[model samples]
Target: MTIVDTALHDSLRVLKLSGMLHTLDARLVQAQAGELGHLEFLQVLCHDEITRRETMSMQRRLRRARFEQTTTLEEFDFHASPKLPAAQIR
Candidate 1:
């Protein structure tokens, strides 16, 4: 990384943009390879930060919910219990 890149990363860290900082290297590579414009680069960085925050929030909510097991209906075998009311479950 160049001096400018190091300085920018330090500034991002100080500003508590952890999400952007974490993805900085990969995003930089993508920007260079894709020849992304300034606004496009900024958009990607902002999106990464937003996605990180949202994912973290959802994880926190899930932990608070304290589910015994993480399961989805798609993994369920409804046919195994023929008596189960599939329509009511839905």
Candidate 2:
């Protein structure tokens, strides 16, 4: 992998580890803005290893939440309900 790709891969790993992408638009990004945009986004983030890890950790936390992945209304309701036990949020 190029530096960009390597950094992006690492950042992505960290994001997954930290569970940040759960909040974004959910799942895959827009179909039209695939590969090329992905590469650009990675490049934009790959400036330095320290910056990359720091950003990955920060954005990963803020970018997405795991609850967004639910499609079922019942599951969504339960996840959204603050009264529900934390364990059941999945």
Candidate 3:
């Protein structure tokens, strides 16, 4: 069944709460099934919004960084730079 009507969806979009909007249908189902209380439902929604914002912020920062390629220190070829200070690099 559809729990979120158009008005509610538009309201959520206007408030920029995409995470809550995305999960609202499933959460509503859970609430109707008696698996969540009012307080718990609100808490979960707030948590989802916070998580979404954090993830978006991180992605924005990474995109701004504009790294040529993705790599990690662990993937470095220590054997090729044996003469270098591998211990210090690690």
Report lDDT (CA) for all predictions: 0.89, 0.50, 0.89
Q: Which pairs clash in the backbone of model 2?
A: 20-60, 22-65, 23-64, 23-65
Steric clash pairs (candidate 3): none
- Rank candidates, TM-score, best first: 1, 3, 2
Rank candidates by lDDT, best first.
1, 3, 2
Model 1 lDDT, full chain set: 0.89
lDDT of 3 by residue, 1-81 (tens): 335577788889999999999998898889989999999999998999999999999889889999887667888788887
Ten-residue segment with the worst summed lDDT in candidate 3? 1-10
Candidate 1 — which residues are off by over 4 angstroms? 76-90
Deviation (Å) of 14 in candidate 2: 0.4
Error of 2 at 24 (Å): 16
lDDT of 2 at 18: 30
Question: What is the Cα-based lDDT of residue 50 in candidate 3?
Answer: 96
Residues 1-90, candidate 1: write the lDDT tens digits. 899999999999999888899998988988889877779899999998999899999999999999998867777778999899877897
After TM-score superposition, the amount by which residue 41's alpha carbon in candidate 3 deviates from its true location, in angstroms, is 0.3
Those runs of model 3 whose alpha carbons end farther than 4 Å from true positions after fitting are 1-4, 72-90
Q: Model 2, stretches more than 4 Å misplaced?
A: 17-90
Question: How many backbone clashes does every candidate have?
Answer: 0, 4, 0
